[model samples]
Target: MNKLNIDSLNFYFSKSTDVNDICVKLKSFQKKSHQLYKAHKHREAKQIALAYLELTDSLITKNNDDNCLLENRILFLNRLCELEKNHENYDKAYHYLIQIEKTINDKPVKDKINFQHQLQNSLNKAVIKNHLNMPQKAIEIAKETFKENISSIYYDKNSIESLSLEADITKTLADSYILLGKELNNASYLDSAFYFYHKSYDAAKIYDSSAKSAAFKHNIAMTDVLMARKDYKGAINSINNYKNTANSFDYKHHEYMNKAICYHALKNSDSAMYFAKKLIHNKKDKCRRSNLITLYNILSKEYFNLNEIDSAYKYSKLEITSFEKARKNKEKTFQLLYNNDFAEAKKLNSQIIKQENVNDKNKLIYIFSIIIILLLTYLYLVSKKKETNQIILDLKNNNVVEKTEKVAYNINEDFEAEILTAINLMEQQDAYLQADFSINKIAEKLETNSTYISFVFNKHKQETFKQYFTKKKISYIIDKLNTDTTYRKYSIQALAEEIGYGSSSAFTRAFKKQMNVTPSAYIKSLSK
Candidate 1:
């Protein structure tokens, strides 16, 4: 990575969603992981973790939360887990998991979830390795790193950040424990793994992250994958969902691996060689390196499939080189991230300590006074300004106006109609009637800036928004006066209400304010 590209400054300090840049930062973090693990470097690691989390939070939160940023999402998650693991921060993990699970529940990004799951699985395997006696499987699992995070773009609410939080990773963690239990030959370890997995799963299940698909479909897909793993031909029937999903490559790897194993069982050298070669080439990361190498031991298998002994021998020689290269790359990336993370952590701690000791009361007072002056100036100009669509947008700061979940309007429709339509929609929501239903509130609903809404309203409406919006309410009152006798049933106070009014006195005040007459007088005019 270029030195300029990789930043050790910390996550929140850098506000970018560039995955490559994030990856570079993560690589730097990985470089420091080891040094930070040492006794002296512990504070350093803690600081790096703090800085990493701050960035994670800042990145996750945006003016408009767009979770389509798959890599950033994954990196945030990955770093969170790594930080928690080093610190034994189950509470922090729980918090992070809450955010992740909420995203998972809210969005339907299958590809992104798969990447998340892969990282999680790697973590599960790592934790279980020390406790379990399955050295072989643990070593085999270690090879399954470097899975790139993928994003799944579904419908509007399908983005993770847009969703409400629900925690489900606990179940995934539990499942990993169950698998670990089976791998453990010792019954005691099995029980321990079972208890842990059960606890995790129970907590996770409390979370409800429903896919748009039905619960039955989830069961069916899960069952099919499990069943397919049992019978090769059965997999041919059951594995289509598994084979075609975002995790298809994983299924394909297993399929080819199974075919190779079956061919070997049947002593069919010709068939085994074809599947074996395909496995190494296409499903490179899926199969075990030892099993991959053993294929070369079968001199007869290679010749039969390729129709040339020499070709078989060439592939056999290539496997070791490929494995070694992959291993070296992992080592290099891991080391780089570890070193950077350690250094940044130490720097971060020093900075935080320095900041804690410092005070700036005089400077703060000066800043506050400036802010107050600026605010008063802003309010005065706004109230005094001529009201137009532009003025309205400006008054409300564009974003504070009422909004619909309106897809962004096109360039062609820049008129009063659009603003009217938006206002009407908000009115329909009874937003205008609410006490909190100010221009700012509306702009927030529309996800635009308050100033921009005021601009549009002022430019097109030709009247100040306050006056215009009041006119609309006055018009509504007139409509009620003409159409609804329900207004007459009340006293001047009651009559004010048949339409929308907070209080009888407010109605009288507004009626006189708008019509220059009381509600009682307006009724007498109608009688005449």
Candidate 2:
């Protein structure tokens, strides 16, 4: 199949004046975009769909009374929503879904075709909501859509399209139910989830969609693994069974991750580490942030169990970084939804006033409620900023340095000298650069106990072991950041990793406590 060229599309759209010719071109573009999407060329498909939307918007504005053009506009929006949802760009998907909902609402459902379009819109909304973790709302929408589908199927029995819709709706219900069950720990909800999963699988088989059948089958197996908490052996068997049919990247990732979890639970550290490392080395780029976090955590624990302190610390830091990324993504999604909701509220308020049907008392209450919400949001942000500022101020005022005066201890002078010499040797070797370097490790190296090392530090060094260790590490990093231009070029995460810190935030806190400035500020000062 020939791909749609953007240049040719733009040129033809610009030159064409005939409505019939333009509509035909748009239909052709739609088919091409769908074909690319089916072929898994999502990026290309999105580009074509976006171009189609832009062209359709222009045509609709010029021909506002044309129902055909309006219907095509809805189709374009729906396609964009599907593309964004598949990419896990939930914010963009929700935006397109809102547009689709508004378009469908503006036109009455005059035929079975329009009713199907409305059902599709509802299904997309429910799926997006579920992805955003609003499972209850998702379930409500899915159930409503399922009821509509059943009604349509009663009249149009033996319709393959109806079976396809049934499969999609039930699968959505299963997913939402699972999420709700996990959140609330409700056994009934889990049972309902399994029921819907089986229903979805049966419908997919009847619809002759092998891909959908395989996907629902994987879902069932994974759910079984998750619920079999103490039965690691059973979980392993389920994962092995699913592995035979796991052709997609996501399915295979789940298979490996579950296997690693089961083996780790079974006390097979080597096998667990092998599978976890395989995931990282083979599919790191393609893996989701959450999956990377899980893999890193598994590897960290396995290495810790094997007494490989350095490897354990490295993977722990990676897990922390992945967790931070996932948190930021969630925050971004929430911010997008918050902004959209606020705008929608304003739009609804305007429509109510324009209609002039609402009484003044009710209008006052509605407006007042919106004002209160805005005020609360503003106050929450201000309070968060104040808390952060107070933390920085406290850190700046607190002294981390050891006192000059030290008290005498009853311990033998010869043993104190031996501990001091061991510490000096370790310092000279730069052993503190290891993240897991601690009093216990030093004691093990010196063939002594941690109590003796702690005693020496407290009685002679005038500081605790942790304080002394942190001071050494932070001081070294400070000197490097000042003199090494290459160090200044690194990101905070890279800088933290360089000094064996598990998280950038922890490094930032230490830097702030030591230098009374954040790492970024210190780096900026070096540039100046």
Candidate 3:
């Protein structure tokens, strides 16, 4: 069948409709379609858009003599691509994008219109690849053009088209870099992501409110990259500086969520809970269900830490309900927004299930070990307390201060004093109790470097940083067991949570390495 002649198509739309008339009609249709889309009338909006496209399509001549006609057709094609992408019709979006590319390539010389069209094609194609969970492909597509045109993009910031394209491409590169970095566990990729996010912000038009809002969002995303790297202090500092910008951009909910996460990372549970609860009570309607689920999960954990069992249970149930609701109400229109992330999460979940299935025998053995430990714990607690007191008394009588070991070499007086003071401050402040605590964090707080902290532990403490820190924290747990009968009754998991370990297995391994005794053995011996 022959394709219909575009010149003869008419439904109150003339065969001689000029480019300006077609554009005006297209814009009006777009405005109405957007309203319908927001109202969740996607079918009606799609039908209207298809009907409107027929008129817009007829304006372009086959010869491509009219520049205005070609430009208008390119604009319509880009709009259709966006609409299809939003609908999660990736194949259709790709088809429209291909047509757009063909139209742009049909023009031999690189005029202003041709240049912008080429950039639009590159940006759309890269974004589509990203949504398909092909970060490497997205990176390749973006870099192919971005590397060549970067100088031109930077210098053409005076024009809206150039500035918008630059901002869009840089942001896409930033997102691709961060996603790939997280998947590969490569710090260099995260650094590049941050650099590009900053570039995106710089390329944004200062006076355009919409552009500035996007820049603020890019900055917020950079903080998330910092948190992923376990740079909690850096994340907190970033939130403090730009949190207000979120309000100006009508993104106060995002500000609240970021602040909650940062405070939780810092172990300031009270502040975390304050911000989280504020969002739930005041701004719940304004936030996405997925985000609310995250807030609920955070609240549950924080309340559990505080031993507020009722609040913990409440939020835990809320977390489950929120998750189910989010899944059920998943908006297809925004699928492209988180398609790569969702796919990645699904892949991780599948791998975890497969691993669990393969390790069934080890899991059984672990369960039996836990049962034995529980049985021994019960028997020890039932034994006579007089024997326990006698054993403790004997140990007290035999206790003496052990001689300290000398460092590997004589250190400078100033360096020695500085290191000692920093160690003392760490102990006094109980910084080890933070969930995100690390040698790097301590170094930052002490105004030194990780290399120096690692050196101090090795030379003065006769251990690596992990060994030294583990011994210090485990020693405190031992002291608690000796002094408080209630502490001894706590399960290994509960004890681990109390002491800021991410998991009971991690705590157990550290305790055994430091004291040469399993936690269960230590608990039983104390009771005996």
Candidate 4:
């Protein structure tokens, strides 16, 4: 074993005179390792932790009778786990967690200490699984651990240890739920996440750890900012308020990330890019793979916005590489676990086969369902084609007005007529040609609220404001296509942009809906 060169850790590799001496040295080494970790000297901290682990293992081997050494071994393993997890070396971290679990299981369940160790081990495993992107498995582990031990742990909530444990478990549950919700796009799962996060906050408060409470509180506020409310400014305010309270490297890193996300959402790309680059370039702190991916994506987008094609492409490639590395790491860790447990692997294989059989049945049903829907859509489009052709003929003949039966509105007829006239004047001026045009803008020009304009649109035009606006834009574009040969020569993208649509796909969808044929096909027919 190599000596770490620190005065405290130097004795780690040397032969000790007695078990007591070794135990004292181990304590010193553990304390020094924690101090190094808190100081952000992760490499030195890991070295010290590994040395402690080796020393403890050898001591345990020579003196299996000492329960103290066995407990110290678990501590060393947990230290290594924390170190590895901090650096995003999740496979190594998971290996250490598994060692902790085996160590705990080998011991006879005698006291609350062993039970606490077991619960902590389970929490660590769930956290590692979550980091590995197996959030459902994380959730299952957390749920099972809690369900199996709630009676024992719940009764002692007044104890700091119990409260801390509860906070950790609930926080893990919330983290898992957040990941699951994002993966599945389920609001209910996100709501469950918030509930658990609040529970975590409550527990942490009683645990009397300001850092822990602040962390959970930050989680809730950030979740609301990012997922639920999407209040970007509010997110920035929350992050700024709590940033000084971030005691750990993880929370500090999150502060940077959340700031970048909020700035990006607010269209402050420069600020976003600066913070993103700050996090990426910080050598003392390693970013999580997911955060690395997000930062790369932000940098790529910002560079693209500046028209720096090379820089954008560079970060885009980096984003993809980071994503692939994360995915492969998860697979590798999962395979490591699978290879370690043959019976579990066999069971998983059986389940996979059953799932495949069910999927095959579902595939056939989906294919038939798609075919039926396509046939119905085809018939609908055929009828719509006739209607569109008639409208196009009328446009060519300068007879484009279509009448709708007037509907009663709560607003007086004079007010309704005035709103209609304002809308017609805006349409005549081709105000919809602006890409940012909206009902609100029209309402502003008319000195009226959007609600009244929306009411008039719904009641008079028999369509919502959006639908009416889309029809007018499409109708104007169709008229241009009929009258202007130059319009037919433009590419689909150019045509879309000419009519204030952001992308060709959006234009094509709207054109197809209006004309029952794609813009490209319609243009080709006009050319013929």
Where does candidate 2 clash, by residue pair?
A: none
Candidate 2's error at 157, in angstroms?
4.5
Stretches of candidate 3 exceeding 4 Å from the true structure? 1-20, 27-51, 58-70, 76-99, 102-110, 131-133, 148-160, 205-218, 243-248, 267-528
The window of 10 residues in a row where model 4 has the poorest summed lDDT is 336-345
CA deviation > 4 Å runs, candidate 4: 1-20, 153-155, 209-225, 247-252, 323-528
Q: All candidates' lDDT scores?
A: 0.49, 0.72, 0.70, 0.74
Candidate 3's error at 311, in angstroms?
Answer: 8.3
TM-score of each: 0.27, 0.55, 0.47, 0.56
Worst 10 residues of 2 by lDDT: 336-345
RMSD of 1: 32.1
Q: Which regions of candidate 2 are displaced past 4 Å?
A: 1-20, 107-109, 152-157, 210-231, 243-251, 283-285, 332-528
In lDDT terms, how accurate is model 2?
0.72
Candidate 4 global CA lDDT score: 0.74
State each candidate's clash count.
Answer: 54, 0, 0, 0
Per residue, candidate 4 scores C-alpha lDDT tens digits across 1-528 of 222235544454343433556676686677667767766788898898888788888878887756667777788888889988876778788888888888887665446888889889998989988876789999999988787566774447578877788778888998888887767777787788878887777777765545444564655445452544466777677777664555433566667888888788788987897689778867767787767877877776676666444345456656666655655666666443323333432343344445546656887999999999999999998979989898888898996678987554488788788889988887887778767788898788778889888888887688898887888888988898999996776667657766678778898999999889999899899999
Summed over model 3, clashes come to: 0
User: Between 2 and 4, whose TM-score is larger?
Assistant: 4
Name the best candidate (by lDDT).
4
RMSD of each: 32.1, 19.8, 18.5, 18.6
- Give candidate 1 regions above 4 Å deviation: 1-237, 240-254, 261-271, 283-309, 322-528
